[model samples]
Target chain A: MKNFMALISGILFSLGLGLSGMMDPKKVLGFLDVTRTWDPSLAFVMGGALVITVVTFRFILKRKAPVCEQNFALPTAKDITSRLVIGSALFGIGWGLAGLCPGPAIANIFTGNVQMILFVAIMVVSMIITEKLVD
Target chain B: MTISSEFTPLLSLSGGIVIGLATTLFLLFLGKIAGISGIVRGLLTGKKQDRSWRSFFIGGMVLGGLLISFLKPELTAKVYEFDTFKLIAAALFVGVGTTLGSGCTSGHGICGLSRFSKRSIVATITFMAFGMLTVFVMGA
Candidate 1:
């Protein structure tokens, strides 16, 4: 049941990403290019997502555990370490350069674009390398 | 440097609502944060017991764009105009950064901030500011 839910959620999320133009690298870069011609549409997407999340999350979190699980597997780390800031800064740089993030890049797999494939492959390898190093 | 007037606020809002709904479902039912970076990380470093659901979730994401393209046909477009080397370099940074940062835009920007985690708030601001700076510096 939980697996099904995860699958469903992933699909819905990706579908939203596609429909909202989040999957478009140009749109993403445009949004980030605030000093230049900017696309404010993605802000509405973030705002819309944030509002729903803020409303629903607190209520769901109040329940101790999720509906189908023994515990809520939430992110618990809360330190403002250099790793967090440096890593984020790096991610932002990459995002600005390529306008590709994990979700959109993953969804772009269906495009059959060799460039997307290469990008995703490299991204995965980098994740693994970082995971090992961090551990 | 001009403001773009091609704002699709309604479309973007509906899309965001869908994303929030999907993420909320994952949190409420699966007890997982529907973060793409974390999910991808899990796939790379899999615990046998947690593998199936993760795979299913990833598979769904891969198909999501395909499904939408199938339905709309006209909405299909590719904006990855970067050169081969640049794309690869960016991917490396994104992967490492997300892992070390412990979250990406969706994880921190959407889910983390929603949960009001101070760490995420800091990370989101840092990334966005740096991202803007990078674009400005590179003139991209």
Candidate 2:
């Protein structure tokens, strides 16, 4: 049941990406391109997402415990450390250059976009390399 | 036809509503948080017990996009444009960064921060900062 739900959610997210023009690298790039033909559409998307999150999470957390699980696994660490900064910088760089983040990148698969496939492949390899290096 | 000025906002609201509904439904039905980072992590970790939920979560995201596209063909046009090399490089960088950060934007920015997580706050700030800096450097 959990797996099924997760899969469903992923599909929904991908569908949303496709529908919103997020799967198209050009759209993403346009959003990032503040100087030329800047598209603030992504901001609206983020804003919409933020509003939903604010309202729903407020109620969900009040339940004392999650419905299907014992408790929400929250991250405990808190510090403006080097790892956080470096990691974020890397992620940002990737976003600016590629114009596709992880969520939309995966979602792009449905579009049969060859560039997205190549990007995903490189991402996977990078993940492996990073894991090994850090280990 | 020229792009509707209202299209982005409308799509964003609708998308948000769908995501909210989906997250709520998943939590109520499956007892889970709709954190993509956690789902992807579980999928990769090979925890048999965790696999099913992770798969479902991922599937839902994909299905959501497909369903929307089918219903709204006009909205399915590609938005962003980038070279293949740049995209691949960016993907690789993000993969490394997410792994190091221990979570993605969805996990930290969306879910974590909502729960008043300090870690997430820090993560979000860092993510935004880096994002800004990257764009500045890339001149995109």
Candidate 3:
């Protein structure tokens, strides 16, 4: 049941990503390129999502546990470490360059785009390498 | 700055709402944040018992993208092109960065920020700033 819910959630999330033009690297880059004909569409996407979350998340979290789960697997770390800032900064540079993040990149895996395929492959390898180094 | 000609406020907003709904469902039912990066990482490094749901969720995303491509081919179409070296560089940065940071756009930007997490807020701001800066520096 939990897996099914996850499946449903993933589908819905991807559908939203697709419908919102978030799947396209160009669109994402367009949003990041603030100096030249900035695309505010990404902002709207965040805004719209936030509107829903901001309103309902509080109530949802108020419960002792989720309907189908025993506990919320929430993030425990609260520190603003250099790891967070530097890591995000690096991610931003990559995002600006490729306009592909994890979600859209994964979704585009089956699109038969060789670039995307390579990108995802390299990204996965990098993740593994980072993990080994960090651990 | 001039607005891009391709801006679609309604479509993007509606899409966002859909994303919001998905995350909400994820939290409400599974008691987990619908963070793509965290999910992927969990799939990679988490315990054995936790793998199935992550796989299912990821599979669902891939399937959903495939479904959308069939229904609306234009949505998933690649508009811009990047060189091979650049793509590799970008991918490396993203992979390492997301791992170190513990989230990405979905996890930190949406889920984390929505939850009013200080870590997420900082991560989001840092990424956004750097993203814009990179675009500016690269002149892309």
TM-score of each: 0.95, 0.83, 0.96
Who wins the TM-score comparison?
3
List all candidate RMSDs to the true structure: 1.9, 3.5, 1.9
Model 3 bad stretches (over 4 Å): B1-5, B78-80
- For model 1, residues A4-112, the per-residue Cα lDDT tens digits are 8878988998898987878877777778888888777888888989989999999998998998889988887878999999999999999988878899888887775
Tell me which residue pairs clash in candidate 1: none
What is every candidate's C-alpha DockQ against the true complex, given to 2 decimals?
0.72, 0.50, 0.74
**lDDT by residue for model 2 (A36-78), tens:** 5567776665566667777777777677776567776555677
Candidate 3, residues B1-140, lDDT tens digits: the string is: 22244888999999999999999999999888888987887788778998999999999999888888888867774444667788999999999999999899999999998999999999999999999998888755
Query: Which DockQ-derived CAPRI band holds candidate 3?
Result: medium
* Native-to-model Cα distance after best TM-score fit, residue A119 in candidate 3, in Å: 1.2
What's the residue-level lDDT of B84 in candidate 1?
A: 78
Per-model C-alpha lDDT, please?
A: 0.85, 0.64, 0.88
State the lDDT of candidate 1 residue by residue for B27-85, as single tens digits: 99987788899888888696878888899888888888778767753333343456777
lDDT of 2 by residue, B31-66 (tens): 565666456655775468877777667666656655
Which portions of model 2 miss their true places by more than 4 Å?
B1-7, B27-33, B68-81, B136-140
